[model samples]
Target: MISIPFSGSKRNRYKEVKQIIQDNGYKKVYEAFGGSAVLSVNLFREGLVERAVINDYDRLFDLYPAYLDIKDTLIQKCLEAGFIKSNKRLNATQRAYLQSMIATIDEKYWRLLANNFVFSGKQTGSLKPLYFTYFHNDITTDKQREYLQTVQQMERVSMDYKAFLKQYFKDFDDTTMIILDPPYMNSTQKAYDNRYFFGLSATLQMLQMVKEMQVDFIFFNMIERDVIEVLKVFGFQDFEVSTRRITQTSTSSREDCLAYVRNHF
Candidate 1:
């Protein structure tokens, strides 16, 4: 899979999460917030699912299937944007160029650059500080080429999860499952602008709808009061909670209940 740098990517937990899906014997999979397409691509690559569908509100996801069509141009442009090189620190002119390039590059390339290079990999709409000197060496032409092979003509939808399910949930059968990683429960309003952000009420509503449909689901989130209450109301009793945090050069544990709920309603 192409290693796109993404903030809050579930890359670290993919294996653990995939095991839950495997144990549940879901033949068809849908990732509701397909961030980085990490889980979706891995499932497809490993032949773990008969069909995998990915959807997200992020605009960049719309261009994923087209990565092959523009891979070479994007690589050259990334080189020009200084992502293919090392610079532990940026000089004034280099910073100025990046600040200006933000407006000059095509939207797709800009999205790629910002998401991959910016500090924390945030969608800041401007050139934020660089994350570090060098991107992972794996982000090379060969990698993109291989990733294109996996994503080309793959099933994907760019829309809100609610609307997406409204249109497509009936297509799923008992063998199908939804894997969800919506924004954190206490996310700031700005962080989850309700436009692209799935809020708590929306999440609760989706859970209700999924229970009604009786499709199995695997959900990832932080354990907050409302989440626990919702789980109680839905009659879901299986969940795992742990503390996980990662930094640039270190991994640390914190005191919090990071929840994983597998609801076989």
Candidate 2:
């Protein structure tokens, strides 16, 4: 899996989830909330899924086409704007420059710039770049090439989960699988700043819709009693539990689960 600098990335657990899909004999896959597109990219690289549908309501999808079609210009703009080769905390001048870039650059490239450079890969806080001191030393030509190549090879869609489901996965059979990683109920505001967030009510509705669609799925979220109860209400009795070590601290951890739902017969 690629090292993506996005909030809520599941890079560490990609192998486990991929194994789950393989074990269940699902060859076609859809990702409803492709935040960092990490899982979809990994599946694409590993050839686990024959048809991979990557969809997201966020502007992050814009990066796919931009990276694939206009690679040189995108990298050149980042370099020219000092988004690359520097990791200083955003000063007044640097902040102003970023705002200007946000206005002028296409939404996809701007999304990449903000998330890749900003602290915690989040756009909510003060615009502090990812690395304070070793920023320049960390990025290399090889990493950039790998990222761009992965983006170019992906099949990306820019749309809401419901729309994508209705359009693509509505007729999915047992061989098809969908991965649903909606905003966690407990960390909606913290991880995504309430932007593009699927709140609890919306999440419940989506869950019901998924149940009705009858497509096989694996849902991921931070474990909580309320969420578990709701899953049980939807006939989800079993879950694959795991520990997620939060990046901000080593001692802190969260119980996470992958709730698998097989297709209706």
Candidate 3:
């Protein structure tokens, strides 16, 4: 299995989600908010789905293809920079080298490296002074190869989730399962880049749109009163699941709920 050092990644929930899809006999999956694209990759790897699509609003959407284009170079650069071989905290000089690399390298490589090195896998454009954390050595050569192989099998795109849904709705069928893991209504947005924040109105609008489409879907979110009420209005029932909540300051396990319309099954 390929692990993505990304905040809000569904690594922990992949097994349960895969089981749900398998039990429902879904042959296709559309990851509406593909943070790391890990779920889709895992499903494809495990042969649970015949087709997978990964879409995201951020430029991180482009990183997968970029990685594929320069997998060797990126791996070599990380190894040369002492990022892939060690799991220790970076010293001042080592940190300076990383910052310099981020400042001077191509935007794609820098963004990929920045995410890997940042604290708790929170997305950042550049490391904040005094906020740089220990280097994550999880993306080794073998892992990179695994990621490349799985991602190559997926259809990836960068677009607004609303636009993505509207365009793909006609293509959905009984065998298709839509995975909606939108940004939480109650999160500080620190886990995400500032520009990708999904506010309440947008969340409600998305829910209303999905309701109208009447597609088979699984929606993940933090438990919030207004969001839950809106989901109830749309006929979505709550399924309580434990998920680790990652924040800028700390990480804790919490009960997160996913809403699904019972009639869809």
Candidate 4:
């Protein structure tokens, strides 16, 4: 079993979010975007969140993480993906054949489609990118081993936020803190890397619902044209805190864009 270090993600903002929740005397926390679940895992680890609800639309968000109670399936999915990848770098015909063979398959075969899509070069098809790419990293045996170990660990102690909420949040209101890390509208232009496609208007509608929840809230978003306009509509007059976008791949044209918030002001 290879060791997988706990590399932080955009959810690293959980540290600050945790402090805000605690300082505000919140008892229940909600992590709505739950990709990688870095926010849920870290806050739960720190014991800052008493009860939480972590939800995401992505299947991989649930399929891969231990928090979703999917531990034993990791190794199986990896194996089903088949370790003997097309090392020769499949030609167009071979790639097409593989895609044809794997498309519209079952959840058990998510690994196969994922492996061929990525290692064989993802072909265009009706199945959403997120559907096939869930197993994209399954191409390497060593990487699979590492993934299995991590999923095992995440399963062993991962927070089941949904279960926690159903049993606890029925009557909770103001004491609840909702933390949103939804995909930023500014990130809409990116398509090459693994990014879940979400309708911008739909996301805005959800944010509107979040505002109506009357629960204390915080949000993480990339500062961009669409976002500023959305925030304005939501009655956010001042930004609580802001940080510059980092990393070399974070949109060259939007390097000036940042991660900002509305609740801080």
lDDT of 3 at 78: 56
Candidate 4 Cα errors over 4 Å, as ranges:
1-8, 59-62, 65-170, 189-197, 224-226, 248-265
- lDDT computed for candidate 3: 0.67
> What's the ranking of the predictions by lDDT, best on top?
3, 2, 1, 4
TM-score ranking, high to low: 3, 1, 2, 4
Better of 3 and 4 by TM-score: 3
TM-scores, all models, native as reference: 0.75, 0.73, 0.78, 0.54
Better of 1 and 3 by lDDT: 3
Quantify how close model 4 is to the true structure by its C-alpha RMSD in Å: 7.8
State the local distance difference test value for candidate 1.
0.61
Q: Quote model 2's TM-score.
A: 0.73
> Which tens-of-lDDT digit does each residue in 1-265 have in candidate 4?
1222222245445556666666767776666555445555555555666665555334443444332223234335444645233335445544454444445344443443344345333433234434332233333345434454443343222233234334434655666766666555566443212344545765687666655544455666566555667777888765455555545343553322323343432
Residue 127 lDDT in model 2?
Answer: 37
Q: How much does candidate 4 score in TM-score?
A: 0.54
Please name the candidate that would achieve the greatest lDDT relative to the true structure: 3
Identify the superior model by lDDT, candidate 2 or candidate 4. Answer: 2
Each candidate: how many clashes?
0, 0, 0, 2
Q: What are the per-residue Cα lDDT tens digits for candidate 2 across 1-265?
A: 6655553547777878788878888888888887776787778778887877788566564555454344345345656767645555656665665455455555445434543445543544343322221223334345555765775677777776888899985558888888888877766353442355566777788889988887778787776565667778888655544545455445565656666666474
Clashing pairs in 3: none
TM match of model 1 to true structure:
0.75
